[model samples]
Target: MSLLDASMNAIHLGFAGLWVGSVVFLTVAVLPLARDGAFDAAPLETVTSRLQWISRISALALFASGGHLAGTRYTVDSLTGSAPGYLVLTMLALWFLLALLVELGSKRLVGGFADRKVRQPAREARPYFLAASLVGVLLFLDAGLLSVPTAIPF
Candidate 1:
């Protein structure tokens, strides 16, 4: 690979790792701690907001780098017809789902806090967070798949 290709791949994978790690951390650590009352509403809100911000920025980076990688690696027909291409398409779908879940969940969580004068309960937030985190995990797995050679030659 050219230096430019290597750089783009690094950026893409870095952002992807950041996105996945943040989601996993929030879902596994933050939520459970908040649920157990280790973190009060105010601090939990701040942490959640910050995590959301990081997720947003990381997602943007991923999109940009992913686009560059896609352009370098794929043609339209090959992407649709090949195993690697299909994995890429699946990753794109997972990326979209992750974005949607994060956006809507953040809005709803923030709105509930505003309306109720308190953070949304962890139980209420759990499903959304879990779903988003699950998507992140799927993305990570898809990326791993992309790194390995497929049985079917493309």
Candidate 2:
């Protein structure tokens, strides 16, 4: 009865893993190097832009398909009956909001970094990047831990 049967499940899992992996790599590995100024802004910005683009695309696909699946199966009662589903939904909303900020920062003005004359442009990047990584970690863990079948039959 689950429309997200095996093939759909596999696809969803793959997308989730890729998105989660990107965030983990950025958080656990890349951030420290950036903090140490191991690379210049130009190159760092390029990498961040590409990765975020990829992550956003994958997230869009995941959310779209997941929404369809949910609509086809779970009623409002079923949805509200569990802690995991609600938690995942809330976490995803937070992640999406954070992503919007990152997209604006990178696209509109590089967080005003394009205007190199400003003293605070580079500093602004640090906080945005940090928030992106932490939110990614939080949502990734929440989704994984919540998505599994954990019903205890008594």
Candidate 3:
């Protein structure tokens, strides 16, 4: 790979890992605490805001980097015709789902936090975050599959 391609790949992978990790952390750690009243509304609000920013930044970075990689490496025919291409498409779909879930979940938390309703908001947002975490895991698995040369039959 060219240096530019390598750099883009690094950025893509880095942001993907970061975003997924954040979702998992929120789901596994923060949300549970908030639901148990371990976190006050102000702290939970800050956490939600930071998560939103991370999700937004990561989404943009992945889009730009993935777009560059796709443009350089795949044609329309290949993308629609091959296993690796399908994985890429799957990653794209999962990326969108994860983004939407995070947004919805964060909105719920923020709204609740605004009213000093930590536990209720955390309770409401839990399902969305759980789904987002699952999608994030699947996204990483799809990416790992993409890296295996023999996994792609093209």
TM-score of each: 0.88, 0.68, 0.97
- lDDT per residue, candidate 1, 1-154, as tens digits? 9998899899888888887787778779887776666766677678679878877888788788888899888999978988999999999899889878877666655655544433346667778889999999888878887889564344
- Cα lDDT for residue 114, candidate 3: 60
Writing each residue's lDDT as its tens digit, candidate 3 over 26-98 gives 9999999999999999988888999999999999999999999989988998889988888888999999999
Ranking by TM-score: 3, 1, 2
Model 3 segments beyond 4 Å from truth? 152-154
lDDT score at residue 83, model 2, on the 0-100 scale:
68
Report each candidate's C-alpha RMSD, comma-separated, in the order given: 2.3, 4.1, 1.2
Q: Clash pairs of candidate 3?
A: none
User: Which candidate has the highest TM-score of all?
Assistant: 3
**lDDT per residue (tens digit) for residues 39-143 in model 2:** 566766676777678778877877776676666656777677766557646655865765665664445325543543222443445566567667766766666
